[model samples]
Target chain A: MKKILIVATIFFNINLLFAQSSIPSVDVKDINGNIFNTSQISNDGKPIIIDFWSTSCKPCIKELIAIDENYEDWKEETGVKVYAVSIDNTRSVNRVAPLVNGKGWEFEILLDVNSDFKRAMNVVNIPHRFLLDGNGKVVWQHTSYAEGDEEELYELVKKLAAGESLEEKH
Target chain B: MKKIILLFTILAFTFSSLQSQNADLGQIHGNFQMDAQLYNNDSLIGANVPSEKMGLNSYANFNYTRGKFNAGIRYEGYFPALNGFDAKNNGVGIPYKYASYTSEDLTVTVGNFYEQFGNGLVLRVYEDKALDYDYALEGVKLNYKPYKGVYIKAVYGKQRYYWNTGTGLVRGIDGEFAINDIIEKLADKKTKLTLGGSFVSKYQADKDPIYKLPENVGASAARINLYRGKFSLTGEYAYKINDPSGVNDKIYKPGEALIVNATYSQKGLGIYASAKRVDNMSFQSDRNADGKDLNINSLPDITKTHSYALLAMYPYAIQPNGEIGFQAEVIYKIKKKSLLGGKYGTTIDVNYSRVHNIQETQINDTIAIGESGSLGYNSNFFEFSKEVFFSDLNIEISRKFNKKVKATVVYQNLVFNNSVFNNGNYHKTIYSDVAIADITYKFTSRKALRTEMQWLRTNQDKGEWGMLMLEYSMPHWFFSVWDMYNYGNPEENKQVHYYYGAVGYINKANRIQIGYGRQREGVICAGGVCRYVPASNGLSVSITSSF
Candidate 1:
């Protein structure tokens, strides 16, 4: 069984090369304590960036701040939207609202205390990011972030906003 | 031999079978990871060289979903297990597999599943790969949303014990209701209210020949939440019947716990505070299992989880036997262009927490308190023992100096009772003051350099220490080096330096990192669970990806 799973891993990787998947519908919570569905996440026919973060994850905080520093300009220029998702469990779930409010980040915040949405996205680590086009189709994704990785991400966002995404052309 | 050949043949067949499907049929997705290490000897650090000379651990999960039906399986493989991992994990098998169906507001699942109720006082099923902890229940689960604001769930299963399942039978039911969502008149009100409750029970056959034990144990918890304007408050209380397990010294003591927290958050500032009390709250599926097996509940600690390497060395371990604690924190952002805030802005964070043993008294003078087969001891709910377990005071300030530079400074004071962990050494308390300076310089839009300087001053245990780290990162690649020096050892020749270097590459959802270094022996924790890593010198490689 283990050997078969190895081959399955390779097979899935290969199959994903030509795959285009939309977001999965999973139950999560908004900052207001409302149960929201992931399928409702949209940017009014514009680009969207979904970020997974936690309070204890330093790199996740860095990446969010790095983007927040220029979020206004990015939103005004491209009409792009960013959704910061907190994966803090019950131990720190209450801290999410306060920290986000204190930081004054101008983005939607969702709480995934049970990690349901994270498991649906096949995300294994924090600082994981996903870029979706106007059609709600995932165009690009990354698992880890360095100090300057946001620059590369912004370039992708620019290309995507210009109607250069593969799905958009189709 | 023949078994290997058979497995490979099946692998190829399964791959082709899956590849033949068209995109319109359904969706397939999952992730995979592999970690391998090469070990070496180092006497100074007391590193041990295993006979295998190497270790390899890997696993993969595949899930298929089509409309309302979903299914998945996970396979794990270990080559004689890692140095610190349990020997029982040396085999290969599929320990997790499940299928579920959902229609409208109702869903049903069979096989392995993870869950948690309220504050997890009565039940919680979870897994942490880094900590080698998974209590996934193999059973049947049901979830239903009968009304607008009403939700209910029920579970019946046995706990997963490594490759097999525990013999005990466990069952639970949980229900939650949102008053604002259900009521038409209060829907638009600013004040919101929610209430929840859970009941969990376990049954094990009594096979002990010496003393009669309870064949059935039950526990329950109740929770409430209120939100108004910028303030929110939550409270949860849990209780358990008499459960004389291996961890509680065979005392027939009922368990109970209470947790309460309040938060006031608004634009530019946030404040949070909470307190908790636990007494004899150890509930496990197996009466004789010790350590991390078959645990049915987890306690939340009133402390912060630090990410800094040095600061994480002395984390507080939650005491399930009995404990009392409180925590408070404030986050404030200095306005931009202010005297203290640069052109951008400054963020200040202050956090403090302390924990201690609960006060306990004898039932009577005739019998010594906590005697075997007795009702244990009595305690005042509002009192705490003089012996302090842990305390921490920390503050952090972050600011962007300019367009090309950013900096953060942190200072902390910590006190840890090492005696609890040192087999009652009596006077092994450790007190330390830590300071750290972190700076990042952006050379270009796609390139950056980061550095950190950390110092820890102490007069106990291993004494003072210093650490330095440097990293250079590009758009897709990164290189980093770090070193930790124990410079103030009581014994002159025992002082040593631990260093490590790594190079990693990241492209989209795929990553590979290679490193060679010396690992320090310490405890790594997530939530309330923890794992101990032994000191070793070695080279390691890891690869991970998701699709």
Candidate 2:
């Protein structure tokens, strides 16, 4: 039975070569404990930034704070939406909402307690950022963060919102 | 061997089809990481002399995804492993691989997988590389959601132990239901409720001569979550049947755990409180395994996780056998224009946590507190013991002085029972006060400098210590230097200076860092899980890239 299933899976995946890049339809929970499908995330043709973070990661917190400090300017310049995904697991999941509320960050916070979405996205480290185009295709991705990394991210967001291809320069 | 050939064949066929079709071909993405260290002996700080004098750990992951189908594999290598890592990890190959398919209402996964059920009180399969821990289950898993707001998951597997599977088999199932979503009328209401339950069991052959042990150990948990506007409460209760294991000294004692959390938050203020009690709740896949090995469940710690070097010197380690703990925190932001707020407003956070040994009474006058082949001990579920294991109170304040300057200050008071947590000869309690100040100044839009000064005062363990760190960063490059000095040790010869320097470069999706440092022997912790890091003088290099 297992061999048959493996063969069947291989055949099905072979035909999937022509599929477009779309967000994985994994289930994630909001701060209020409501489940939502990742494929349903849309901002009406605006580009989106998904940040993978955890409560214990200092670099991740620093990156999010930097983005938060300049969030209004980025939104005003380009129709960009930032979603902060917390992969805190059960060990630190309880502290996530309080931390987000305390920081006064205006980004949508999603909980990936089991890291389903993180594993699906192949994120190996905290502070991993994914830039999704208006059509929900991932156009650019970066890992790690320094002091001035948010500016680079904002520039890409502007280019993406303007319907420019990221593959050329970035 | 056959599986490897099959995997390669599939990959080759997939790529060939992609080239011929000239289609989207889905996506193939992965990441690579390598950490190498050259060690030197330092007798003063008890640094061990490694026979190899160097170690390397590396891994490369490849993931392929196409709509509803996905597959991945991780290849790992450890040349004699790191100095402090388990020697058993000296060699490695493909420790993790998985294939999965998902539809609108159902998902199926085979091969190696990681999973958790209901806050992981009952079961969890995960990997933490820093701890040299990877217990991914070689398993079959299924997730079925027949209706809105309902989720059901089933898993059967044997955990991975080094290059081989553990001696025990694990099986579990979980179900969750959201009341508001399940009932249409309540969907639009403000209040929401979720209920969940799980049952997990592990089977191992009993081969002890002194006592009779159960072959199948079972654990179950029930949880509830309620949310209304800005207030929310969540709780879970778990129970296990009598199971003898090494951690509990082979005692046939039933285990129990309860965790409750409540929170209320608004725009500029957040409040949270949580309490937990665990009694003899150490569940493991292998009955004889100990430490961070072959664990099937996770016990949440109530202590606040500190990020500062000095503040984290003495971290809390969960005593899974029996512990009762509680934590409370409040975060408030002062209005911008107020006197204490300054121009950009100030935020303050206050947190406190405490844990104690659970009250236990001996079964008989001479049986002692816990004995083998016994029920361990009897105790009142809500009783608190007079002995305190750990306590901490901390406060932090942050403010932006100007567009170019920002500062943060923190103070912490901690009481750690070294005798209980460390299990060493020093049986005295440690009382310490730590202070930290962090300041950052942006030289320009693309340049910045940050500094951290920390002081820890304690007369018990290592005495008073001080640390200073300075960092300079540009758009893609960063350099840092730090030194920690233990100046007040009673034994003058033991006082040492631990210094470190590092440089890093980051590109689009890649980073490389190199550092030379004298590390102080201490406990490093992540989410209350503590590991002892041996002192060492070493040069380390790390590289990470994703594509």
> lDDT of candidate 2 vs native?
0.88
lDDT tens digits, residues B339-392, model 2? 998887888999999999999999888787788888888988999898889999
After superposition, candidate 2 runs with Cα above 4 Å error: A1-21, A168-170, B1-24
lDDT (Cα, tens digit) per residue for candidate 1, span B1-547: 5565566567655655665664344577888888888999998877788899988888888887776787889889888677777777788989999999989999899999888887788988877677787788999999889999888989999998889988888899999888999998999999999899999999999887776888999999999988998999988999999888788877888999999989998888999999999999988999888658888887877788888887877888888888899999999999999998879899999999999989988888876777777888998897888878989999999999988899999999999998865447657789999999999999986688889999999999888889999989887788989998888878777687889999999888989899989888878877656777888889988888887
Off by over 4 Å in 1: A1-18, A166-170, B1-23, B425-427
User: How well does candidate 1 match the true structure in TM-score terms?
Assistant: 0.93
Docking class of 1: acceptable
Angstrom error of the Cα, residue B177, model 2: value is: 0.4
True contacts kept of 2: 0.43
TM-score of chain A of 2: 0.87
lDDT of 1 by residue, A59-136 (tens): 999999989988999999889999999999887888787788788887899988778788788888888999999988
